[model samples]
Target: MVMSLGQGLWMAINAIYAVTVVHLTPGQLGVSVSVAAAIVLVCSIPLGHLADRTGPRTVQMWSFLASAPLTAALLFVSGFWTYLVVVSAQAIAYRAGRSARKAMIAGLILPADRVSVLAYVRAASNVSVSIGACLAGLVLAAGSRLGYQGAVLFTAVAFLLTGALTAREPRVPPVPATAGSALAVLRDGPFLTFTILDGLLTTHALLLDVVLPLWVLRRTDAPRWMSAIILVVNTVLVVGTQTKAARGTDTPAAAARASLQGAGCVAVACVVFAMSDEAALVPACLLLVSGALAHALGEVRQAAGSWAIAFDLAPDHAQGQYQGTHAMGADLGKMFAPAVFTWLVLEHGALGWIVLAVGFAALGTAMPAVVSRGVRMRSGSDPVISTG
Candidate 1:
């Protein structure tokens, strides 16, 4: 909740703040954000290794501590370089702790209940983000530099409080490293393939975040306010239904099936969204709402399924490194989402949406087979195990 609130407060105004206060051009802002993601991508593995060596709790606490000051330092950035440095540092600190935090969750929950717990966390995060974004909206309305600074400061304090709270959580014992090097995760073929597939599946999220808004603005006749409503619908649905979606994703096979179902929902949503292109405003609004709800359901199912697969496949002793490796998929997806969606969906129009839907279905269909193969291989001679 703390993390989501902080993120929401800053994200609501980050682009405007950069342009008006930091004086960065749109292109520069884009480049700097990309650079920050790249930094996280490059550092994820090493930080995960660090988490494995020490413990997730320790690494997570320190990461929050490091991130708080860097986030606050954003208030002082004067130029593009300074902005890049501060943003990049904050990104690094945040990403560095992600795997450890995930590993900590894995350690805390039963395997059968991980998805449910994750769903609750995700739901809570959405609620908190909504609150934060609404608060930030009030601040943004004030239109003062001091208001923006206050938002940043609020984020900084949130991080500080989070770090302090994290420090107080019960500690989990670290698994002793069995391998000589952290790079061992790179050599795990099945896990690597899983990561790639996970990355592909994650593109759906990118579609919702980047493609949907652009499509609504450029392709549909719906009013601008509908975009905000679509997002609200998605958030509300996730908050209300995520735990229910995660109910039966306990086993690997069940999770794989859930993912396939999720893909189907996403495909249906895409087709529904496509129909809005030339429709009347009422029809377009209804279709958009329907699509958003479907997409939200897909998001919940995919997230629940992915958690099970990820936790099931990761080696117990190296959960941090494996989870970190899994995170690379999200990083890569975010990095390429804009260019990929522009070329594949936006520029091509409605046909592009169909193509993406088909692609999602294909990926979803293949996931079960891939997971089965990994399970078979593990059961044969490799015997991958999770102590958590």
Candidate 2:
């Protein structure tokens, strides 16, 4: 419940940030997001180390508690550079907090069920985000800066409350890593492949962030209100489809199948988005909603696959480090996608969208084969592994 509330408020605040405060051209906005994401990627490894050395709960509590004020400070700032600094800080806090949270989940949930729980958590988050985005849209439409400011301010309060809630929870026992454990992770080939593949999949997904908005506004002559359209599409698909999409995918093989199908969906949706010149709002809406659902399905399956694979491979003492490294792949995708896609759009126009579509489609087709190989290698060494 706390996670849901936090996501809802954060999503609303994020929409406000994109619309009001972070004033940049499309490419510049992409650059800002990329830079911030790069910072998160760099920080993730160290932060994971911290979570392991300390405890994931400790990291989560402190990060959450600190993030509230930093986020609220955005209300007073007016300049782009200042916004960047503050937003970057928020990004750091969020990434660190998330790693800790995921690690905490690892401690309690059985590896096999972790994907289902993650899916449930994601569904709750999307539902909350939808609520938050809708409220933000209402505030924007009303032209109430004070009200919008109040909504953001309230979000900070909610974060504080969430921190308090987390503090009251039981802590996980600290897991220790021996010398050379981190170095060992660096040399693991299948692990590296999984990370890289996950990164590529994620990178393609983020094209929807800054680029989609700009495309809608500039190419379709969409009203500023059209931003809400995309959000709605994402909200409905996530809320409606993710749980079912994640169901019946317990084994590594099954999970890979779901991911491949989901990837195909993403490719088709993106192509439809690119071809929507005459269809206007309907095509854009379909692209946004269908793509979101497909991408989210892939997230559910890939998350399950990654967790199962990592838990199988990780030494008992080094779980946190492995999870953290896994998390960094996601951050790297977030970092690189914006810059790459922004360049593609500028240089190639509609061709860029087609390229992104094809890349995603290919990944979808290929992931199952790769995952199957990894699963086979893992099973050979650890036949009775506990997979989450």
Candidate 3:
């Protein structure tokens, strides 16, 4: 929650701060962010390997400490190049910590409780991010460059505190590096396949964050406020029900089943969203709400299931590297989502949404077989997929 809150505070105002205070153009900002994301994507595996060798707790703490100053450096960025350097450095520090953090969770928690614990953390994160965003709104309402600067400073302090807290966390012993290079993950065909499939599943996030709001405004009669309303509803529902949705996904098969259910909800949401385009205002609003609810439900199920698959499939000795490799899929999905979703939903409209829906459903349907086959190939026993 602390980490997410800090992220929320910065994210809510960063673009505006860049435009108004740092005087960067939208295109420059986009390029800088994309570049930063690319850096994270390229660096994650190496950093994860470091964590595997040196211990996740140590790497996580140091990464947080490193990020504090880099985040604060945003205040001094005046040009596009300076902003890019600062933001990219900050993203490198941030992304470097991610796999270690996941490894820490896996190291400390029993597998049976992993999904529930992750759900709880995610719920808290949603609530805290909402609070942080509200606070950022107040800061922006103060309407000055100094106010934005203060927001950046607050984020830096938050990172410092989080780093301090992490430093004091109970340490988990490092796993000794094996004979092969960390890049050996590249040679693991089944794991590579799983990661690609996982990445595809993450496209649903783009559907919610990018496609839905644009579709509502450009194609439907629903009021603009409905978008904000839908976001709030999704947040509230996720916070309230994620733990419940996480139940019963204790095995690979069960996790795959949950993912399939999530895909079905997402598909239904697309159909409902399409109907809103031609409906009366009141009916459109209702359909929009219904779609948002379905999307949120799908998000909850997918998150739970994905966590299970990722944690369970990872080799015990190479957890950090494996987690890092899994994370790459998400980064890749998010990087491509804007262009892909825009072309599909905005350019082609209802038929495009249906096509996406079918695609998602097909992927979900294939997941069980894919997971089963991959696990069998890896372990030579179907029941090993159920192991914690």
Candidate 4:
């Protein structure tokens, strides 16, 4: 929650801060931000490897702490280059910590309980982020240099407190790497395939946040306010139903099937969304809500399945690197989603929506076979595809 609150404050204000305070052009801001994120892709794998060699708890705490001063330093960033350097450094620190934190969770939590527990944690995070966003809004309302600086300071303190609190947790021992076994996750062909599929499905995130709102404003007759309502509906459902969605996905087969089911839900949501473009205002509102509900449910199930598979399929000793590798797929997905979905949905119209829906469904349907192959690779039998 502390970490999220800090993140929420910065994220909500980041672009605005760049433009208003640092006087960066929007284009420069975009380039710097994208460059930082691209750097994270190169960092997560090695950082996770470092955490496995070191202690995950120690690595996570330091990563959190490292961000504190960098975030605080934002107040002094007068130019684009300085802002770029600080933000890039902060991204490397916090983003790499994700692998360490997930490794710590895996070390502490039982495999069977990981998915449900993560669901609850995510729900709580959503609530906290909402609160933090409200706080950021208040700062925006105030509209003073002092106010902005204070928000930045508050985020820095939040990071500090988060790190200190994390330091209190029992330490997770390092996974010793042998000459032959270092970076073992990179060598696992089946797991790599799974990661790619999972990443592809994760693009639904960008679709919901980026394309959906634009679609509402540009294509549909739905009231403009309905876009915000759609987001609210998604948040409420995810907070309420994520745990239920997470249940019954303990094994690799069940998790794989859940992922497929989730993709199917997203496909349905996409179709509903496409149909909304031609509807009356009242009908469009209803369709938008329906699509949000389906997409939210899909989001919940896919998240659960991904968490379960990340934990269950990973070898215990190399948990950190494996978790890092899993996360890299998400970064890759998010990087491409804006470009991909914008062209497909916004520019191409109903046919584009149909193509997206079909694509999602195909990916979902194909995953079971991939999961079966993975299971076979591990256990020397195609057990789950037939039985599950």
Error of 1 at 66 (Å): 2.7
- Model 1 bad stretches (over 4 Å): 10-34, 73-84, 136-150, 178-180, 211-228, 275-285, 342-352, 381-388
Q: How many residue pairs clash in each candidate?
A: 0, 2, 0, 0
Tens digits of per-residue lDDT for model 2 on 1-388? 6545545545534534555554555565666677787788777767766777688899999888888998789787676677678778988898788777777777777876776777787777777777766765665566466766777787788778888888887797776654334445566666667777766775645645556656555665445445555665666667777677667677767777766776666676566566643346666555555555555555545454555545555554555666777777777776768767766765566777789889888877787787777777666763533322
Candidate 1 has what TM-score?
Answer: 0.84
What TM-score does model 2 achieve against the real structure? 0.85
lDDT of 1 by residue, 1-388 (tens): 7977886666556766776778876457656766777778888888888888888999999899898899899889999999989988987888778888888887787766777888899898888776776666676567689988999899999898899889888787876766446877786777778788877787787565456655665677876445446656776788898889988887778888888889888888888887787667889899999988888888889888888899898876787888998988777765765456645655677788788788888888988898887787767655563222
Evaluate model 4: give its TM-score.
0.80
The full ranking of all candidates by TM-score, starting with the best, is 2, 1, 3, 4
* Residue pairs of candidate 3 with colliding backbone atoms: none
* Deviation of model 2 at 245, angstroms: 2.1
Clash pairs, candidate 1, are none
In model 4, the clashing pairs are none
Report lDDT per candidate.
0.78, 0.66, 0.77, 0.78
lDDT per residue for candidate 4 within 1-388, as digits (tens), equals 8977766565555555676788876456655655676778788778888888888999999988998999999989999899989988987898778899888888888877878889888887766655665666666556677878988999999999999998899988887566225556777877888888887887787665556755765688875445456655776687788889999898989998899999999999999888887678998999999998999888899888888888887877778888888887776675556556766776776777888889889988888898888878778554322110
- Tens digits of per-residue lDDT for model 3, 1-388: 6877776666556656776789875446556666776778888789888888889999999889898899889888889999989988987787778889888888899878888998998888878766666666576556588888888988898888889899888898887655347887777666777787877887787665456655665677876445546665677788998999999899988988888888888888887787776567899899988988998998899888888988888777777888898888776665655556656776777787788888888878888887777778678664433211
Per-prediction CA RMSD (Å):
3.7, 3.8, 4.2, 4.9
* Stretches of model 4 off by over 4 angstroms after superposition: 8-37, 69-87, 133-154, 208-232, 272-290, 343-355, 381-388
Lowest-sum lDDT 10-residue window in model 4: 379-388
